[model samples]
Target: MDSGLENIVAAETVLSDVDGQAGRLIIRGWPVETLAADKPYAAVLGLLWDGFFPELGDDAEIQAQLGRARAAAFALVGTFPMESGVVEALRTGWSLLNDSEAFDDAIAFPAAAAVFTAAAVRHGQGLPLIAPDPALSQAQDLLRMMRGTPASDAEARALDAYLATVSDHGLNASTFAARVIASTRAGLGSAVLGGISALKGPLHGGAPGPVLDMVDDIGTPDAAERWIDAALARGERLMGFGHRVYRVRDPRADALKAAVSKLPGTAGRIAFAEHIETVVLQRLARKYPNRRLETNVEFYTAVLLEALDIPREAFTAIFATGRVLGWIAHASEQIGEKRIVRPKSVYRGPVPEYA
Candidate 1:
């Protein structure tokens, strides 16, 4: 049995493909770069959910529906106490969704995720909770509610690109978890809850926050090389330099790095991050030439979100905000197949003795 399930093919999908050796990502017949470069977050959702939800018509209609959904999600904010971080609050918010219908959950899950995450952030800062703006795009509205003002076009676009880049990927851990729940004929809300819970694990969604920690500890461009050398010498795993799926550079990294570069007032930070990346990659190459330890999505995810003024702790929550759409879409696909996902395992333990 393959303990890690490495190189195992479990299911077929039309959503996205990860060509690890080629360092390419294709989402719904479009490259990730193309989607992130031009399309807004809602448009990506349109692509994913197309033909699945006939009720969603043009982009205008889709955006309007999402706006109303956000309003609906806002109505439920503060219903639960923020006893923990935003991710947990988001999971709770997802649980509170009464949507059993796939399309309904598709609309409500992202809406509730954004609202709950923003509300949780505000609660942590002792600031009054802000309402979702029905007139704004998902990315724009998220920033507006968090900062209590409209985000600049560049700022909104940065988040939009990030959302697009991560919207869907081939059968990832969280997506697989979501699809498993959906295969059980569970509703979309239940599937997305499973996705959110799986994403909270460090091996999945927790690295982006720690990438910021790595940058903060490195402190400066001049110090990056030495710190990386010491970290490698001590056998500490570099936070964002490698990926489990992508054997080469993560395509999402370049997509997000470009987005971060376009943001205002981030030149110095970008240059410094570039230097640290250069040093880390060079050291990694020398340390293990056979393994592809190139930079991954989490590295640039931290940079872009930090430039967006999001707190490090909220990183995973925002990732959930972007990824929830993909989860619902996958669930819808799984539900359509009418097959429950179950795999047999080898019995390695000693045979039971019978009298």
Candidate 2:
């Protein structure tokens, strides 16, 4: 048996393709770079959910519906545990969703993510929760709700790009969890909760936070090379330099790096990060010539989110806001398959022998 199931092809989907060797990502026939540039999160949602939800008309309508969903989800924020961390409070918030219908859950899950994320962050800081505005786009409203003020056009666009960039990928850990629940005919909200639970694991959704830690530790571009060498000498894994799937540079890295560069007042940080990145690559190349260790999405994810003034504690929740769309789409596809996901196991322990 293949213990890790790395070689297994579990399901067929028209959602997205992840090419590790080539370091390319395509979602619904559009390259990730193309989709992320100038496309709003609502538009990406429209592309992923097309033909699945008949009620969703166009990008504008989907944005409006999502806005309404966020507003509806806001009323339930009182039930969310105020004392818990943002992710936990988000879990409580999502657990309270209506799971009776897929269509409703489809709209509600993503909407709730943004609302609960903002509310949880505000509650943790002892600040008042901001209500959702139904007319605002998802990215704009998410930032507005979090900060209790409107985001600038560039800030909103950068956030929208981030949301679209991470909307979907092939069956990674969380998306696979979502599909497994959906295969059992569980409601979309339940499936999405499974995704969230999986994402909560440090192995999946924990890298971006530490990228900032690494940057802070390095302190200066001139010190980065020596710092990286020392870290590697201690057998510490450079957090953002490698990915499980990608042998080449992650395409999403460039996408986010570009987004970060366009934002105002990020020039110094960008240069420092680029220096650190260059040193890391050079050292890795010299240390292990055979391995392809390049920058991954986590590196710039930290940069962009930090630039947006988002608290590092809320990184994964922000990620969930974007990735919930993928979870919903994959759950719907798995539900349509009408077959449960079941794999065989090899028995290694005690076996019975009959005469």
Candidate 3:
């Protein structure tokens, strides 16, 4: 048996594909780069939820519905414990949602993620939560809710790109969890909770924050090479240099790098990150010529989020906001199949010898 199910082909999907060797990602029918650059978060949601949600209409309609959903989710901000971790608070808030298997219920997961995430951030900073504005786009409202003011168009656009870029990929760990729960005929809320639980794991959605920490630890462009080299010599894996998949550079990395480049007041950080990225790539090449260890999404994810003034601690929760769309779509697809995901396991434990 393949312990990790690496070679196993589970369920087929029309949502997204990941080509590890080519380092490509396709969502619905569009390449991640193209989709992320062109479409807003609402458009991507509309694309993903087209056949799943009967009421999901055009991008404008989806935006309006999502805006209302965010406002509805914000009503639970008072229930979340400020002492709990952001993700834990998010989970608590999500648990309170009605599991009616309705389109509005499914949409509430992403909406709640953004609302709870923004509220959690403010709570940590000893500030009151901002109410969601039903008029603003999801990305703009998310930023506004966090900062209590509107984000610049470029900033909101950069965040929109990020959300769209990471909306869906192949069946990742969290997505697989979501599909498994969905296969069991659980409601959308249950599936989303499964996905969020999986994302809380460090190996999955927790890398972006550490990438920022690594960069901050390096401090300067000139110091990057030495810091990385020393870390490598000590057998510490660089946080953002390699990926479990993606034989070459991650496509999302370039997408987010471009987004970061378009933002104002980020030139110095971007230049420093580029220099360090070059050094890391060169050093990695010299060290392991056989392995395709290259920059992954987390590298630029850190850069872009930091540029947006997002706290490092909230990076993973922010990831959930984007990825919740994929979870809902995949769950709906799995539900349509009407098949429970159950695989036989090999029992290597000692069998009882009974007479």
TM-score, every prediction: 0.98, 0.98, 0.98
The residue ranges of model 2 lying beyond 4 angstroms of the native Cα positions read: none
Cα deviation at 106, candidate 2, in Å, is 1.5
Candidate 2 lDDT over residue span 1-355, tens digit each: 7776778899999999999999999999999888878689889888898878888778888888898899999999897586869888888899999874457667998898899999988988889989999999888898998999899989999998889888898999999999999899878888889998999899899888999999999998889988999998998888888888899999999999899889999999999999999999999999989999999988999999999989988999999988999999999999889899998887789889999
Off by over 4 Å in 1: none
Sort by lDDT, top down from the best: 3, 2, 1
For each candidate, how many residue pairs have backbone atoms clashing (under 3 Å)?
A: 0, 0, 0
lDDT of 3 by residue, 296-338 (tens): 9999999999988998888888999999899999999999999
**CA RMSD for every model?**
1.1, 1.0, 1.0
Give the CA lDDT, 0 to 100, for residue 42 in model 3.
89
Pairs that clash in candidate 2: none
The lDDT per prediction is 0.88, 0.90, 0.90
